[model samples]
Every structure is written in C-alpha cells, then in structure tokens.
Target: MNATDFIVSRNDLQQCKSIETQPPEAAALPADALLVKVTRFAFTANNITYAVMGDALKYWQLFPAPKDFGNIPVWGFGEVIASKHPNVAVGETLFGYFPMATHLVIEAADVTKRGLRDGAAHRQVAAPVYNAYARVSGDPAFTGKQGDYQALLRPLFMLSFLVDDFLAENDFYGARRVMLSSASSKTAYGLAHLLHRRDGIKVIGLTSAPNVAFVKSLGCYDEVVTYDAVTSLPADSPVAYVDMAGNSDLRERLHRHFGGQMKYSGRVGLTHRSTSPEEPELPGAKPSWFFAPDHIRKRAREWGPGGVDMRFGAAWAGFAPKLDQWLTVTEGRGPAAVQQVYLDTLNGRVPPDQGHILAL
Candidate 1:
C-alpha cells in the first residue's frame, strides 16, 4: 500500500501551498504517545484567527513542540489508533486541536494540558478542560436539539462569556452603545446575544448588506447596520467598537465615523485574512486586543475557580440553543474543494455567521 496520505498545507499568506507527499514513516507517532487518526474538523473563526495572526498572539510561538519545529496551526478532531498512556487507549475517538493531517501522534501530556473532549456514547472520553467537549449525541444524525449540538457552541460561547465579563468589569471610559463588527459571525452573535439579555446597554451589529437580514434574524441587537452604512450611524455616538472583521479599512472607517465617541475599541479577530499582523490601534479610543486565556487567567486569580466556573457555566447554558442554527458542514477531501474553501474563508467570501465542518 502507498504510505502517503493527502495533507492540506499553506506556505505563506492565503495561498494554497500544496499537498505534502510523504511516507507514514515521515509522520511517525512517538512511542509514548497516542496517535489520532483524524477523520473530521470544523472550520471556525477561532482557527482562522490562528492561521491569520500566526505569531502575533501571546505565547503563540512560545510553546515548545515535540520537536524543535515551527508553529503548527492547532485545531481539529480525530480517533485514536495507538496509545501508551493508560488514560488513552486504542480505538478511542477524540477531538481537540490535534492537527490538519491524516494522522497525528499527540503526547498524553499535551492532551491533558491542551484538553480533549470525547463521549461515552461515542465510545470515547470527553476531557473539555482546555475547551468544552461534549458527547456526539445519542442519535447518530444531527438532531437539531440543544444536547444534540452542544459541541457547536462550546468554544464560541466561552469566548462570548469572556468578552461579556471583561466589558462588565472594565471601565469603558464612558462608552454607551457597543459597536460589534462581524455582527453576523457566531462569536459576535454570541456576544450580541449575551449583552442583549440585560437591559440598559445597546448592541449595534455591523456586517455586509447581504448578511444584514440574517444578523437581524438573531434578534439580539438594538440596531443592525451594514458595513457600507457606517456614515449612517450616529456621529460621535459615544460607543465602544468591538472589531471582529480584521479589515484595516473597516476598522479605520468605524474609528473615523465614531471618533471620540468610540471610547473603547478592542481588536478581537482578523477573520478576513489568513495571514496579517494585528491591525494597528485606531487613534483616540482606548485600544487593546481580547484574548480568552488572558481574561480567564486574571479573573480566575481574582474571583477564584468556583466563582468564575459558575458564571461561565451559566453563560454557556444560556447561549447553547442559539448556536445550532449557525453551523454548516461540508464533506469530501478533494484537493480542489478544500483549497477553494480555504481561499474563500480567507477572502471573507464565505458567509460570516455560518460554520464549516470539513470531513476528511
């Protein structure tokens, strides 16, 4: 049998690098680690952030890999084919940031450190400490119910909860309405939904004209406006702009339109591009980036694990149902199809709110 298995790769920027032609010996699993045979992975905005931001995010390039290798894009799910760790055994299916390859040997320590989610019903163990993990549901098919789809919202909800907690505790410096770009995206939608639950704050969602209705369909925002409708927004609106679209021009336009009213601006993502440094801060507003780990670390120290966990649990439970409607799945491992999907996502040609599941 041929040893090579197709692996999607990118060289630099958004270009499709090419299929790596190599033998199984070249991608060998460590003797002491479990080897996951990858079967599927979902393309979320979070992975897009990693692909695009690269070395910009803190501790991104700081971690030491099994070998002295360059940075690897960490996200995906798979099944275990081999294992030396007692906790992980042969034939156990797992999901986490395994890799975007046919098979990957993940150290047991890395699994424990990074987190993995498997379910008993699915003949696996679910360790969601690093990120929420769920049972793949009792029914084989997507049942469209909350329990049936908890995995869809777990990661996204954690981010949304973290964002809400940050804004609630921090001093916005006198900002009222929160301007959320990528309003149609799942992450942004999660934020908009959570913030809308309580009164007194306004959620202004910004997206393209095509997604305007879909964004409004979420029914969580006080106002839904298109990107081109920037000028139409209230000038000097005294608002906080939460940027989700990493487009420099849009960030500049939002800053210019709202000006001093844009009291606080947080750079959360560059979902539009697969390779670009974090956007330069907009002048005038208090600018910084939002990272879930940093926020969780600080809060965990101050509030302790119990308090933070309880709060986060409630937030996750609240947004659980809404997430199901936002996911889209695609099958096949055709080189051309995967290439097109990657290019489309990088170019912002894909719909902002829809999630993509890639079947390998």
Candidate 2:
C-alpha cells in the first residue's frame, strides 16, 4: 500500500472522517526507526474516556495535548513493515498504543521505552495509564502464536480481572449481593461471568429490556433486572454495586435500595454519558472510582514480579477461552461506520449481546 488510510475526527458531526489514502514513504526517521501498520483497534470505553474527558481530567496534566482537537488514543495489534532496531524487525507483529491513524512511525528509542515514556516524550498524551507498546507474546494466553482477535481483547480481560482483585483485596467482608449496572456492556458481562460461579455471591445485572434477554442468555447472573424494573428489587438487599452505566439516577437508586447494607460501590465506567457531571453530593453508598491503571500499578508494586505473574498471567490464561466465545468481531475500519457505531453506542442502540471489532 503506497498510501496509508485513516479516520480523522471532525467536529462537524462529532464524528470521524475517513482519509482513505495518504502518501507513504520510506522511514521518515533515522534507519533505526520502525514503521508500524495498524491492524485492528477496539473502540473501547477507555479510548472513549480519553475523547470525552479530553482536557478535563486531573491526571491530564501529566500528558499535555499536542493539539486542541481531541486526541483519539487507540490500542491494537500491528505489523512492523520496517525496523532499524534489532529487538524488533521487519514483518514482526506487535500490540501497543497507536492513534486512530493508519500508519505510525516510532524511533527505536521510543519503541523500547514504551510505558516508561512520560508526557514530555510522547506529546499530546491523554492517559498516563497506558504503555506505548506491548510486544506480541507467544504465550498461551494470547491464542498461541498468531494472537489474532484474542490479542485485541487482552486489555478488557485485564480490567475485569483487576476489578475482581479489587473486590478481593477490599476483603468484601460485609458484601452481599453484587449489582452490575450497564449489565449489557461487555465489561460488566465479563465481570459478572467471573464472579457468577463463586459459591455465595448473588449477581444482579441491571440493563434495558432489549438487553435483558441477551444478558440472561449469558447466564452469569442470579437475576437480570432492567433499570425501569429496579423498583422490584428488595428495598433492602444489603448489596455491593458496580456502576458501569454512569447514570446518576441509577447510582442513587442502588444506594437507596440497599441503604446501609450497600457495603461497597465501585464506579468503573461512564458508558451511558458522553461526559458526566461531578457529584457535589454523592449518595448514601459513595462510589469508589476503579481506575484500571492505578489498580494495576499498585498490584505490580505490591505483588512484585512473581505476584503479578501469578495473578494476571493466570487470570489471562483462564479467561481466554470464555472471552473468545463472546467477543464477536465486526469487519472494516472505514470512518463512515465509526461515527454510527459511536452514535449507536451512545444511545444504547448497539446490541448488548455482542462485542465489536473495527478492523483497520
């Protein structure tokens, strides 16, 4: 391909416009630099967060934006077409952070440092949480040698695993029923799957009716409840809640229903709202923010190398098969479809039962 194609975000429709082809040249940098061709990127909640939160996050101060137009941060698998670095060579595949753009050029120096690089290095950085690069692994966790679609899902699985860890670490002493808001969302479904089989935990999934049957098909919850039907729940179930919906009203209802028994409330995502307002008066059961980057970092330090290896590595292996079964892939990465996908996602128009893949 002589020209690289990409989707550029435009304010016109709060949408992305496709740049079908662009002139491609030999390494734009020194000989040691590597040219990476983006393969597939999942339009994930985290990336959406980067777009929506934009310049507002407190941590955004760490990574200054290069331009005013909101940055489109993406994570996906790619192939190295050329490389001057010995560690990475032509034809090698890797997984890492990339912009929504088609072709990316990185110096060997930047490639090697990856996660360690600060905002000063990779300008226009949004989240300090993600590493710049992830070397594709032959480990069994990534579907053997090819990685395939499975590699794209590693980040989602890792977040679910870490959420599980957070519950465990907090001791969950008084925790009883667990309410999963945004029950139709992929992340919520996965978390519910991981916890459903546990001996005593009761899983309650709160979603819309369109998603009710689909979520129930997953069979990972003790009960699937719709947001409108939440009034049917026991007024005092003494529950712990996971708020993925980011709907303040639902958050309030969960707090009120469980009241004092609401032992723990975790806020993991704001999928429902493009941008959520700050809660001046948080509800009865205060929602604790579960930032995956922070959780992983703390665990890495506390568990050391061996601890991380045992927990995350083991979690990845165990969860891989189940994840693959549910993560259905969609084809093509044209920008025209991307805006529709986002719109559907925003209005809860996308089918809750399936996962999405935007092949670039």
Candidate 3:
C-alpha cells in the first residue's frame, strides 16, 4: 500500500510536502513486526516545538526522512492491519507515538496484554515513553471524545504533570509564586491547572495581549499578564519562571527584572520560535532545560512501577472532564486538510481553544 507522509524542512518549517511512498509489504512482515494503519492524530504547538528543537533535542532522529526534511512525531491511534507477532493480532487498535504518515512498521518487543514497545534500533536511545503504545481496549481514556482529548492533551498534560511533580518534589525551589509564559498553550495551561489547585503557591500566567483574555478564562491562574507587562509584576517576590514561550527578550527581561529573587528558571516549550538558541548570561537564576523524559525516568525509580501512573491517572481524571468546557475539537481528513492544519499551526493562526485532529 502507498503511505503518504507529511514532512517539513528542517531549515524552513514553512516549506513542507506530503510525499507518497511504498510501505513494507504486509505479507513479508518480519518476526515480531506489526503494520499499523495511521488513523488520526493531534496537531498542536507542541508538534511545532518538536520541529524547532528537532536538531537540538534529537527529535529529527525519531523518524527518518529525506535530506533537509524531517517527519514530526505525533500522538494518535492506529489499527494493526498486519501482525507477525504471535501475541499481537491484526485489527487491534493502539494509542501512541506515530509519524505524520499513513502507516508504520513496529518491531514489537516486551509485548503485554496492555501494550508493547517499539523495539526498533533507531528508537533505542530515545525515551521509552515515546516507544511505548497502549492497547485501546485497555486504555480507559480511549472511549468517546476522551480519545481525542487523550491524543490532543495527554502527552502535553503528561509533561505538565511531571513538571508539577518535579517542582513540588523540590519544594518549588523555595518560591512562593510560579509564572508560566505562553500561558495559552496547552502545556502552559495544563501546568497552570495543577499549580492553581495547590495551596500556598500562586500561579501567574504570562501571555500575549491577544491571548490574555483566553488565558484568564481558563481560570487556573491567579493572575494573567501580557508580555509587555513583565516588569509590572512585583520584582521583589521570590518566584519560579517556566519558560514556555522561549522568547529570549522576555527571558532576559524576567531575569533582569527579578534579579536574585527569581529562584528557578526552567525552560520548557518554544511556542515562540523567533529566538536565538544561545542564551546570554543574565542576572537571577540560570535557565535550565526541563526534559520531561529524564524526570519520568527519575520518578519511575522513586515511585516504583505503576506509581506514577496511579498518581497521573487520578490527576487526569480531574483534568479530562474540564477540556469539554475549555477546548473545541476540529476534525480534518486527507492530505490537503492535514497540510492546511500543519501550516496554520506553524504560522500560529490556530486559536487557543481550537484543537485539530487530522487523519491521513
């Protein structure tokens, strides 16, 4: 069967194409291999962050592509059209990481009734979370609109959950307030949601003027301020900054404004792509990148097996239902629709409340 992939230029994300190619033959499948038909996936600013940080974070290495082009990874559901593993069967559906393509061939290892890991050689160095897939039947979040919510927000929310857990584990670095930039983005608001629920810590959201109202409507932040108002916040209060926008100027402003009062500066997403990679030494706390996978590994050892899941699952239960009130899902099908959504997301035209679920 022909597989169509949506790939973006590593040098210029705006330059993209949907290329059609031949997939592995189902009949000639290797042992323990499964051919999955890509159903649908969510497109968000998070995917754009993957492309922007592709080289720096090895995101481009996840799925190979032609020279100068890269396949952006996504979270979604797929059906197994062919299977060579005895434990896995055709027609079973799975929810996990997938390329923006029509099909995928997975070398299934560590198979279980719940799911299996993609034991492909190229993916070994990556985080296990990206390689793992869950069976649809076994995933409680796979039902009804919950599945779309899962695809759209679960991965991002997992990052939010981990960041929240990490901060709490460290006693929030002795800061009384936590500030998140790009507050309208999924990950930012997701973190805001968790932080808002906790007492003794104030959650502040930093966003663009256009998104200020939307961010405030989420009602998860104690205060929502625009980018220009960064200096308006009390500079003397001890606070933690979550750099979700990755705007260099804003980062410098926050650091210089707060000076030694900025207890922790944790860099997260790059929703704002027009920024230099080289960080200039500024006052206050040094900026450190928060890699969610590393935190997951640490928690897995500390919390033991299923401990993180139990905690995250309980948190998700509370957060999932809130999406129905906060997000509007928009469905698109075929290559043309997929390309439009990709370009819109890349160009920052997508509204904060709208979520796109595309099928190829």
Best-fitting candidate, scored by lDDT: 3
- Expressed as tens digits, the lDDT of each residue in 1-360 for candidate 1 is 121132223235444433343324423655456656666655566666765554454223322222222223434456667666666657665555544456654545533432443221211221234333222323332233332233345566778888877887764456668889888877788899888975678899988888998888888999988888887987755788788877678878878777777788887877765324465556667567886778877878899857887887788767765655655544446446555666676567777655555543
Evaluated with TM-score, which candidate comes out highest? 3
Number of colliding residue pairs in model 2: 1
Ranking by TM-score: 3, 2, 1
lDDT digits (tens) for residues 209-239 of candidate 2: 7778878887788999989888688866567
| lDDT for predicted candidate 1 compared with the true structure | 0.61
Q: Least lDDT summed over 10 consecutive residues: which range in candidate 2?
A: 113-122
Error of 1 at 349 (Å): 2.4
Error of 1 at 93 (Å): 2.5
Better of 2 and 3 by TM-score: 3
lDDT of 2: 0.64
Query: On lDDT, who's better, 2 or 3?
Result: 3
Please give each candidate's TM-score. 0.78, 0.83, 0.98
Candidate 3: tens digits of C-alpha lDDT, residues 1-360: 688998999998889999997888988989999999999899999999988888877878888899999999999999999999999989899999999999999999999988899999888767889899998865656965789999999999999999999999999999989999999999998999999999899999999899888998999999999999889999877999999988999999999999999999999998888888688998888999999999999989999999999999999988987898899999999999999999999889999999999998
Model 3 clash pairs are: none
